[model samples]
Target: MRAVLLFAVFVALLAATAVFAYYGLAGPEEVALGVHGWTAMIIGVIFSILVGVGLMGLMFFSSRHGYDEPPQVRKDR
Candidate 1:
């Protein structure tokens, strides 16, 4: 099916990109970049916490401020 072929192509491209990036970054000594990995994890955690806090604040405000009430409809003659 077309879906299967598309999925295969996508996977192939993703693998190719991963291989290229690894080769480009790999030096003669083949050292692992620990700082980059840690930095990524730290930033990811911070961003996730910020998003969760924002969502929680929105929910709390909605409940406390009665945001769930329906709007009043107006009719004119």
Candidate 2:
């Protein structure tokens, strides 16, 4: 029942957002090519940097915490 309720709510919100986005970007004003290109490039570069930083952080943390080490073998079976 809870999951069904959640699904219903998600569907409703999805429909609402679809309507909102359609109306929001349906304007007749033409966006410049340079503006679009720069925006996309900036977003892409930022995303790449964020991903690299997160990857390096995770690698450093795991190495320091010994998460990359193999587990001890059990010989007393």
TM-scores of the candidates in the order shown: 0.48, 0.56
State the TM-score for model 1. Answer: 0.48
| Per-residue accuracy of model 2 over 1-77 as CA lDDT, tens digit each | 99999999999999999999887767455753477898998999999999999999999999999999999999999
RMSD (Cα, Å) for all candidates, in order, is 5.5, 7.6
Model 1: lDDT of residue 50: 100
lDDT by residue for model 1 over 1-77, one digit each (tens)? 99999999999999999999888778455566588887998999999999999999999999899997899788874
lDDT of 2 at 27: 48
Give lDDT: candidate 1, residue 42.
96
lDDT of each: 0.90, 0.91
lDDT of 1 at 52: 100
Candidate 2: which stretches are off by over 4 Å?
A: 1-33
